[model samples]
Target chain A: MHRTIVDADKQKLNLNLRELFNYRDLFLILAYRDLKVRYAQTFLGFFWAFLQPAATLLIFTVVFGRAIQVDTDGVPYPLFAITGMTAWTYFAFVLNQSGNSVIGAQEMVKKIYFPRLVIPLSKAVVGFVDFAIAFLILGVMMLFYCFSPSGNILYLPLFILLTIISALAVGIWLSALTIRYRDFQHVVPFLVQFGLYATPTAYPAETIINSLPDWAVAIYYLNPMAGVVEGFRWSVLGGAPPSDFAYISFVLIGILFMSGLYYFRKVERVMADIV
Target chain B: MSDIAVRVENLGKCYQIGHAKSGDFRESFDSWINKLRGINNGQTGESKEFWALKDIDFEIKKGEAVGIIGSNGAGKSTLLKILSRITEPTKGRFEINGRVSSLLEVGTGFHPELSGRENIYLNGTILGMKRREIKAKFDEIVAFSGVEKFIDIPVKHYSSGMKVRLAFAVAAHLEPEILIIDEVLAVGDAEFQKKSLGKMEEVTGKGRTVLFVSHNMGAVRDLCSKGVFLSKGTISQQGEMSKVLSDYVNSEAKINKEGGVVVNVSPLDKEGKWLKGTFLKVEVEWARNLFQEGINFDFSMRTVDRVKLFAFSSEKRPDFKDLHKRSKITLLIENIGYVNNELFIDVGFKYVNKDSYEALILNEQLITPSKEKIESFLRRDILVVPGFQYIIE
Candidate 1:
C-alpha cells in the first residue's frame, strides 16, 4: 500500500520561482511590448532616450558649472552633467513607470490571473532596455570628450543594479498604493519632476554638501539616489569616490527594497477588488 | 476514496457599500468630512457593510462540471473570484488539488494596443501556459477563434465580439486542470455561443474539472450535470441540475405575489409627459380549454402618490364569456377615468397558470406621469399573451 503524505498544516504562501521561471518567455514578450510601443511611431524612437539626458546635461552645464561654479572633479561640465543625468533619467523613468504598472494594467489584472509582481518587474526590465540605449549615447559622449574608462568602470554594472533595485523598491510601494488611491496616478508625474531637482541628478552632490550642516549632510546621505549618483560618477570617472556615503546608500536601498516588497505583497491580494 | 478536486470551507467576502448621492459638491463634502474623521471611510455617507459571499461551503470531485445559477447580486461572481484566486476570501479556506484557470471575463488579459497574435502569447502566459506549449497550440487557437485575417491587427481595432472570440479561444485551448468560467461566453453572436459551448463540452470530455456560472437555464441544463443555486450569498439548493433549477424557479415564484401582474410604463414616457390618455385600466383573462372553466383575473393600477388610478376585473366586462379549450380569451377595459397629478402608474395581475396549483402573480410600474400631463394618460398592451393563436376568416 502506498501512503500519499499531505502536509495539511503547512499553510503558507510560497514564492514559486520555478513557476515564474517557466513563464519567463511571457515576461520577455511583455517587456518587449513596452519597449516597442514606447518608440514604435515616434520620429525620435530610441534617440528620445539620449536627447532627454543630453538636454539636461546642457542646462546643468550652464547653471551649475558656470553660475554655481561647482567642481566636477576636473571633468568637463557637459561630461559630468550627462553622466549623472543618464543614470538619473533611467532611474526616474523606471520608478515613475513601474509605480503605475499595476494600476495602469487594471483591465488585465482583473481579467486574468498571473503573478502580480510580473507587471512592475516587466516595467523595470523595459526601463533597463531604454537605459541601455541612453547608456550608448553616454558612451559616445565619453569618446567625444576623450575620456577613457579606468578599472573602476568594472563596478559600473553594480551601480546600475543598485539603481534598478532602488527604483523597484519605490516602484512596488507606489504601484500598490496607486491601486487604492487613484490620486497617486496624478501625484507620480509631479513627484518625478520634483525629484529630479531634489536629487543630485542635474548637479554634483559636493556643491550641496558643502553648504549643508553636518547633521543635514548625514541625513542627505540617507537618500539612496545620492549614493547612486555619486557612485556612478566615481565608477565612470574613476576619481575620488564617496566610499563612506556609498555604504550608507547601499544599506538604505536594501532596507527600502525589502520593506517595499513586504508592503507590496500585503496589498497585492486586494488589488483586484480595490482596483 | 477522497477524490475531491476542490474543498471550500466557510468562505466569506465583505464589501463596503457607499451611499453617496450622485452629484458633485455634496459627495465631495461628504468625503471630506469622512476623511476628517480619520475613518479611512471606504466610501462616503450612510455607508453599510455588505457580505457578498458569506460562510459558503461546498466540495467538487474531479471531472464534475457544476453550474452556478443566481439572479444579479447573488454572489455568484464573488464565489468564482475567490475560487479563481482573483481575490482572497475574508474568512475560511479553500483548497484545490490541480492547476486552475479562470475565464472570468473573456479578453481580460489582452492588451488593446498589441496584435491578436501577440496577445495570444501574452494571454497564454497569463493563463500559465509554457512558451513551447503555446507555440504548439498557436495555430489551433487562431483557427478556433476564427480571426485569421485580423490576427495581425491590433486588438484595439477588433470588434467587441471578435475580441471575446479570440480571448475565449486562448482560454479554451490551454486546457487547464480546472476551468472556472463566469458568463463571458454570453458575448459574441449566437453562432459563436454555440461553438464556444461545443468547445467547452470537448474540454470537459478530457476529465478536467469545470465550474460554470450563468443565468440562462436552458444552457445550464444542457451543459451542466450538477447545479448550485445561490440566493442572498448562500447556497439555497445543490443537486442534479434539474432538481436545483426547479428549486430555484419555485423559490423565485414564491417571492413574487401569486395573483398579481405588474406592467411598467416608464418606457412610454415622451418629452417629460406620458403619451397615453388620463384614464387607464388593465384586465387579465386566464383560460384553459374550450370546455374547461374560464378564470377571471383581478388587477389594479395606482399612481406613485398612492392614488387609486383604476381597479377592475375581467368579470366586469360586458362581453365576458366562459373560456373553453381553444376558446379566445380577451380582456377589455372600459371607461378609463381621469388623472390629476403627474404620477408613476403601477399595474398588477393575479391568476393561476393551468399547469400548476399555485397562483402566479406579477407586478410592474406602468409609467411616470408629471402633474402637468396628468390629463393625458395612455392605455397600452400591458401584457401581450404570445402563446394564443387566432383563426382568421
Candidate 2:
C-alpha cells in the first residue's frame, strides 16, 4: 500500500524528480500525441514542417540577400539565413506551443493529476522534432553549396542545446502566466512576431557588432537568443566565434531559465482552480 | 491505522468568490513578483471567501465502498477534486493508504484525432495505469467497449455513447487499490450503467476501497455500504447506508415549500437561505407529457397583496429540454437582491404556438411558502445585503 497525504496549506515547491520519472511514459505519450496531431488533418502532412522554414528562407533570401544585400561575409546569404532561421524557428515554436499548453490541456488539468510540467515540456520536444527536420534541410543546403565541414561544427550541438534551454525558459513563464492573466495569450504572438526581427535572424549580427559601441553591443547580447544566433552562425558557417558580448547571452539565459522555473512552480498549485 | 484506506481530517477548500470590480496590471504584477520571491503576506485582492468544503472529515476502511451524497453546490465535486489531487485544499489535510485513482469524467485526456485503440492507452495512462498493464488488458478493454470494428479509426467518428463506453471500459479495467468516481456512470444507456455498477461491485469484492459520488440513490444503495451526506460544504449525516440516505431524504422534506400537483420543489441552499448576490438554484420536477411546442414555464415572485415583482421564463434556458414524461430541471435565479420583504413563488405554464398566451389557464393557483416559515428560516431581524456592510442578528 502506498501512503499519500494532501494538505492545502503545504505547498510542494520541491522539484520531485522521482515523481516526474514515474510519469515519464505519460510525457512521451503526450509528446507523441502533439506530434501526430499537428499533421493529422493537413493536406501536405509532414511536408508542412519543412515548408515553414523553406518559405521563410525564400522570403529572407529575396529581401535581405537580393534587395538589401545584407553582408554574410563570403558565405552564401541563403545558407547563413537558413541556419539562423532554423534555430530561431525552434525557439519561437516552443514559446508559442508551450505558452498555450496549459490552456490547451484545460480539460485534462481539471480532471486528473500528473506533473503539470509535462505539458510545456512536451511542447519543447515537439518543437525539437520540427527543428530536426528543418536542420536536415540545412544539411542538404550545405552539401548543395559544397561547403566544407569545419571543426566549429562540433559546437553545433552545444548551441542547439542552448536554444532548447532558452525556449523552455521563456515557454514555462508564458504558459504559467497565461493561465492567471489571459492577457498573456494576446502578448505571445506579438512577442514571436517582434522577436524574429529582434534576434539577428534575417540579417547578419556582425553588422550590429561593428557598428554599435562596445556597451551598446553588450546590451544587445542580453537577449538570450543573441548568443544562440551568433553561436549557431559560427558553428555552421565557420566564422570567428561570437565576441565577448556573446558571454552576456549566456548570463541572460541562465537568469531567465531560473526565474521561469520559479514562476512556473509558484503558479502551478492554483492552476486547476483558475484553469 | 492499517485498516483504514482513507482518513480526512478537518479538510477545507476556500474559493475567492466574485471577480474584482476593477483590477490594474501593476497590482497583479506586484503580487506575482512577491509570490516568486516567497513573501506571502496574504494581502492580495478584495474577494469574499467562499468555503466550498469546510471541516469535512470522514474515514473509509479498506475494502469498504463509501457513497457521497449531496445536492448541487454541496461540495461533492470539490471534495473529490482534493482527494484526486487535482486541486489543493486551503486548510487541513487528508491521508490515503493505497494507490488511489479517480474517474471524474470519461476520456479526460483523450485526443479526438487519435484512434479508439490509441485513446485507450492514452486515457489509461492518465488514470495512472502503466503501459504494460494497459497492454495486458488491451484485448479485454476493446471487447468490453464493443468497438472492435472501429478500434483503429479516429474517435471523432464514434458516437458519444460509444465514447463513454470505451472510456468507462479502460477506467473499470484499472486495478488501483482505491477507486474514486464522480457521477461518470450517469452517462451511456441503462444497460451500460448497470454493467458499470457491476464492475464497481466486482472491484470492491477484490478488497479494493471505493469512493462513489452520485445522485442516483438506487445505485448508491446497491453498491456502497456506508454513506456521507454533505450540505452546504459540511457533513450532515453519516452511518449505515440506509440511515444516512434516510436522513438526506427526510431533510429534503423539511425544506419542501409547497404541496403542489404541478411541480415538486427541492431547496438549493441549506434550509433555503439564499444569500444576497449569489444565484439560487432550485431543483424542480414536473410531468414531462405536459410539455409542448412553445410551452413555457415562468417563475414569478409577488407581494402578499397580489402585486407581481419579477418574472423569469424558461424559454431561453437549456435545462428546460427533455421535459417529457417525468423530468427534473434546475431553475437558476441569478441574484437574490430582494430585502425587507417576503416574496412568494408563483409558477405558471403556457402552451402556445400562437401570438397570445393570456387566455391560457397558466396554473389554478400560486405556489407560495408560508411567510412565518421563511422568517424562521432566515432567523434574523434584518436581511443583510451582500457586498454591503451589515450584521444579521
Candidate 3:
C-alpha cells in the first residue's frame, strides 16, 4: 500500500512529475473531449481549424507583403507567411487555451484531486489537433507554390516540439496568475494579439533583425518563439541553418519552462481556495 | 497500523474572507498603489479571517464507512474538502494509506454539451480511473444509471434526475481504496438515493474506506459504522455510529437554548425525503412576549434539505389568547410526514381590532429528540399515529 501525505507545508516545491505522468491518460482524455466538443454542433465543423490560420495567412500576406512589404528572404511570400503562421498559430492556440484552462476548469479543480498540471498540459493536445489540420493546410500551400520542402524537414518535429514548449512556458505562468490576478484573464487575448507581431511569424527573422537596434534585437531574441519559428524556416523551407544566437531562445525556453512549472506548483497548492 | 486507511493530526484551515473575494487584479493593484502613497482608507483590504476547520483529529480503519455530521457552516464541508485534498489545511497534516477519490459532487466534471458516453469517460478519468478500466465497466455503469437509450444524446438533453444518475453511476465504478463522498445523496429521487446508498455499502463491503458528509442523519446512521460529530470546526464526538449520531442530534438541541422554538418529530424517516410518519412538537421558548392576541398555529412540512411543501395545515382555530405565558400549543397535523423539521406554527391571530392578521416570523427550526433511541422507535412503526398533547402552565 502506497502512502500519500496531505499537509500544510508551504515549502513543498517539487513539480511531482511522476503524478503528472500517472495522470497522462486524463490529460489526453481531456484533450480529446475538447476536440470533440469544439466541433460537435458547428456547421463549419473541422473546417474552423483550417479556417483560422488559412484566413490569417491570407490577411498577413496582403497586409505585410503588399503594404509594408516585409522581406521574405527570396521565398514566395505566401509560402513564407504560411509556414510561420503554422508554427505561430499552434503557439498562439496553446497560449490562449492553456492560459485559460485553469480558470475554465475551476469547478473540476475544486472538486477532484489530480495533478493540477494535467489540466493545462491536456490543452497542449487540443493545440496539436488543430495544429495538425493547420499543418495539412500548409502542405497544400507548399504544393500550390510548387516548393517541395528541403531535407531540413527532418528537424520539423523538433521545431514543432519547441513551439509547444514555448507556449507552455508562458501559458503556465499566465494560468496561475489569471486565477489570482484576473487582470491577466483580459490581458491574455491582447497579449496574444501583440505576440503575433513580437515573434517573427509574419516577417522573416532576417528582415526584422537587420532593421532593429542591437538592444531591441537582443530582447527580441529572448522570445523562445523566435527560435521555434526560425527552426521551422530552417527545417521546412531549407534556409541556411538559423544563427548561433538562436540557441539563446532554446535556453530561454528552458528557464521559462522550469520556473513556470515551479510557480504553477506553488500556486496549485492554494488554487482550490482561491478559485 | 496498516489497518488504518486514513489518519489526521490536528488539522486546521483558515480562510481570509471579504477582501480578494473576487480575486480582482484591479483591487489588489489599487491597494498596492494606495499603500505606496501612505493611504489608510482601509476599504481595499477589509478581510476577516476565520478557521473553517481547526484542531480536527480522526481516523478510519480500512473498510469503515465514517459519517461526518454537523449543522451548516459548522465546518462539515470544510473538513471534507480538506480530507478530499480539494484544499489544503492551514495548520496540520493527514495521511492516507492508499489511492483516494473524492466525489465532492456527483457530476464533478460533466460537460452538458457532451453526450453521456463521453462524460463517463471524461468524468471517470478525472476521478483517476484508467480509460481501459472505464471501458471495461462501461456497460454496467450505463445500465445502472438506466440511461442506456440516451447514452449518445448530449447530457444537456437529459432530465436532471437522469444526469445525477449517470454521474453517480460513473462515480460508483471508481474502486478507490478510500472514497470520500459529499452530500450527493441528497439529490435524485428517493429510490435512486437508496440505490446510491446500496452502492456505497457495496464499495465498503469490498474493504474500501468511505468518508461521507451528509445532512440526512438517518442515512448516516444506517450506512456508516462510525460517526464523527463536528461543531464550529472541531470534532466534538466520534466513535460508534449510534452514539455519535445521538451526540450530533443533542448538539442541535443544545444550540437552540436561546429564545426560539423547537419542533420534535418522532420515528423520523432516516433516509427517505418523502417521509411517512406523525407528530410535530412546536415548543416556543415561553420567555419572549410573542403576541397579545389569540395565537393560532399553522403547521407545514417540507422534504428535508428541499423547499417543496408536502403538507401545510390549513389553520388551527384553537385560541390560546388567555393561555398563560408558559403554555405549550399542541396542534395536530394529519397524515404528517417527517419533514425537514420545518413548520410554520403560524403564531398569529385576529388582531382584536383589524379584519386580517399577518405575521410570518420564520424562526430557526430545530429538531428536539425525545429521550430514547430513534432506531428502536423506527422498528416498532407504531408511532405513525401521533395526536396532539398540549401542556398548560
Candidate 4:
C-alpha cells in the first residue's frame, strides 16, 4: 500500500529519480509515440532525417569544399562535415523538441501525475533515432571515401553520451524557463538555426580556432555543441584530437546539466498550476 | 486510523490573479529591472490571491462512498485535485492512504495520431497503470467500450462518443484502493449515465473508498452514503448523505431577481412554521409596467430526470385579477404528495393575455428534499398529485 502525503512545503529540488525510473515505461512509450507520430502524417517519413543532413552535406561539399575551401587537413569535406552534422542534428533536435515538450503536453501535464522529466527525456530519446539515421549516413559516406574511422572510434560512445547530456542540459533549462516565460519558446527555433553556424557543422572548428586570439578560443568552447561537434569528428574522422578547449566544454556541460536538473525539479512543483 | 482512506487537514489552494495574466517574459523582465533599480513595480499591489479551497478538513473511511456536492466555483474540483496530487495546496497538507486514482477528466492524454489500441496502452500507462496491468485488462476494456472494431484506428478517426466510451472504459477498469472522480457522470446519455453510475457503485461495493464530486443530486444520492457540501471555498455541511443533500438542495433555492423577474420557494407546515416535505409557498415577482395585461405565473414540479409531474398556471384561479403595477404573486399549495424521487420546481412567468409574448421567462430551479422518507411502494412511475388547495395573493 502506498500512502501519499501532499504538502505545500518541500517544494524544492526533489528529483524523485526512483519515481522517474518507475515511469520508465511511460518515457519509452512517449519516445516511441514521438517517433511514430512524425511519420504518421508525412509522405516522406523517416527519410526526412537522412535527407536533411544529406542535403546539407551536398550543399556544404559544393560551397565549402569546392567554392570556398576552408582547409579540412586532407579528409574529404563530406566525410569531415557529416560527423559534425550528425552531432549537431542530435543536439538541435533535443533542444527544440524538449524545449517545447511541456507546453505540447499541457493537457496531460494539468491532469495526469507522472515524473514530468520523462517528457524532456523522451524528446532526447526521439532525437537519438534521428541521430542514428544521420550517423548511418556518415558511415556510408566514410565507405564511399574508402577512409577507415580513427582508432579514436573507441571514444565515439563517450562523445554520443556527451552529445545527449549537452543537449538535455540546454533542453531541460530552456523547457523549464519556457514554462514561465513563453518568449523562450520563440527563441528555441532560432537557436537551432543560429546553432548550425555557431557550431562546427559546416566547417572545421580550426577555421575559427586559427583566427581567434588565445583567450577567445577558450570562450568558444563554452558553446557545448562546438566540443560535441569537434569531439565527434575526432573520434570518427581521426583529425587533430579536439583541443584542450573541449575540456572547458565538458566542464561547462557538467555545470549546466546539474543546474538544469535542479531548475527542472523546482519548476515542476508549480507546473500543474501554471501550465 | 488506518481505515481512514483520506484525511484533509486545513488544506487550501491559492491562485494568484495578476495584471500580467500569463507567465510571459516582458512583465517578469520589467519587474526584474524595476527591482534592480530598487523601485517597486506595482505588480505586488495589482496582484491578488484567491483561495480556491480554504481550511477544507474532512475524512473518508475506507469502503465509504462520499459525494462532494457544490455549486459552480465551489472548490469541489480543487479538493479532488489536491487529493489526487494534480496540484499542490497553498497551505497545510493532506494524506491519502493506499493507492489512489483520480479521474479529473477522462481521455486527458490521448494522442490523435495513435490508434485506439495504442492509446489504450498509452493513456493507461499515463494514468499510472503498469503495462502488464493494462495488458491484462486490455480485452475487458475494449469489450466494455464496444469499439473493438475500431481499436486499430487512430483516435482522431473515432467519433467523440467512441472516444469517450474508450476513455471511460479504461477509467472504469482501474481498480485502485481509492478512486477520486469529478463530474464524469455528467457526460453520456441517460442509458450511458446509468451504466457509469452502476460502475461507480460497483467500485464502492468492492470496499474501496470513493470521493465523488458531481452536480447531479440524484446520482450522488444514489451512490454515496456520506456527503460533503461545499459553498464558496468552505464546507457548509458534511454528514450522512440524507442530511447533507437536503441542506444543499434547499440552500440552492434562493430569491433570484435579475432581468425584471424574481422567484422564491420555501415550504411550510400547516401551522405556518418553516418546514419541508409539506405545503410550499411560492412567490413570483416581476417589474411593473412590463406586463400590460397582467402576468401569469407558472408553477411546475418535475422529477430530477425532468419528467414534468405537474404544472399549474395562475390564470386558472377564478378570483385572479389583472394588474399593471408592481406585482407580487404568491401561491400556497396544500400538499406535495410524499414521493421519494428528487424533484425540481420551475417558476416561469409571461403576460396572460398575450397569446405569444416576447420571452420574459425566468426558470428558477426550486428543489425538493431527497426522497429518503419514501416507502418502496410509493416510489413508482411519475406521480403528480396536485395540491389539495391553492390560495393566491
* Model 1 CA lDDT for position B327: 29
Best by DockQ: 3
**Sorted on TM-score, highest at the top, how do the candidates line up?**
4, 3, 2, 1
Q: After superposition, how far is residue B207 of candidate 3 from its true place, in Å?
A: 2.9
lDDT of each: 0.70, 0.79, 0.76, 0.81
Candidate 4: deviation at residue B24, Å? 3.3
Model 3 misplacement above 4 A: B19-44, B254-282, B286-296, B300-385, B391-393
Clashing pairs in 2: B288-B324, B288-B325
Native-to-model Cα distance after best TM-score fit, residue A21 in candidate 1, in Å? 4.3
| lDDT, candidate 4, at B42 | 74
Stretches off by above 4 angstroms in model 1 are A1-23, A66-69, B18-47, B254-393
Residue A75 of model 2, lDDT score: 85
> Per-candidate TM-score, first chain only?
0.89, 0.95, 0.95, 0.96
lDDT for each residue of candidate 4 in A10-101, tens digit (9 for 90 to 100):
55557778988999999988898888898887889877877887888899899988999968889888988887888998899899898889
Least well predicted 10-residue stretch by lDDT in candidate 2 chain A: A8-17
Report the lDDT tens digits of candidate 2 across residue range A68-108: 99988888988988889888999999998987899999899
Tens digits of per-residue lDDT, candidate 3, B1-393, equal 589899999999999888865577777889889989999787776778899888999888988999998888889888878888778888989999988888889888899899999999999998889989999999999999999999999999999999999999998899888888889887899889889888877787787789989877656766799999888988999999877876776466433332344443333234412133444444433333554544444444333333333323323433344543443544443334333233222333334455554343232243433333233212122334334444433
For candidate 2, write residues B1-393 as lDDT tens digits: 489999999999988865332224566777779989998976777557899999988999999999999777999999999999998899999999999899999888988899999999899998899999999999999999999999999999999999999999999899989999999878888788878888878887787899999866666877899999999999999879978876776565323223232333333455554444444544455444545555655566554333455556666655544333444545555334444233455665555355544222222222223223222223234433322121111
Cα lDDT, model 3, residue B56: 91
In model 1, state the lDDT of residue A53: 66
TM-score for all models, in order of appearance: 0.76, 0.79, 0.86, 0.90
Q: What is the TM-score of chain B in candidate 4?
A: 0.82
Whichever of 2 and 4 has more lDDT, that candidate is: 4
Q: Poorest 10 consecutive residues of model 1 chain B by lDDT?
A: B384-393
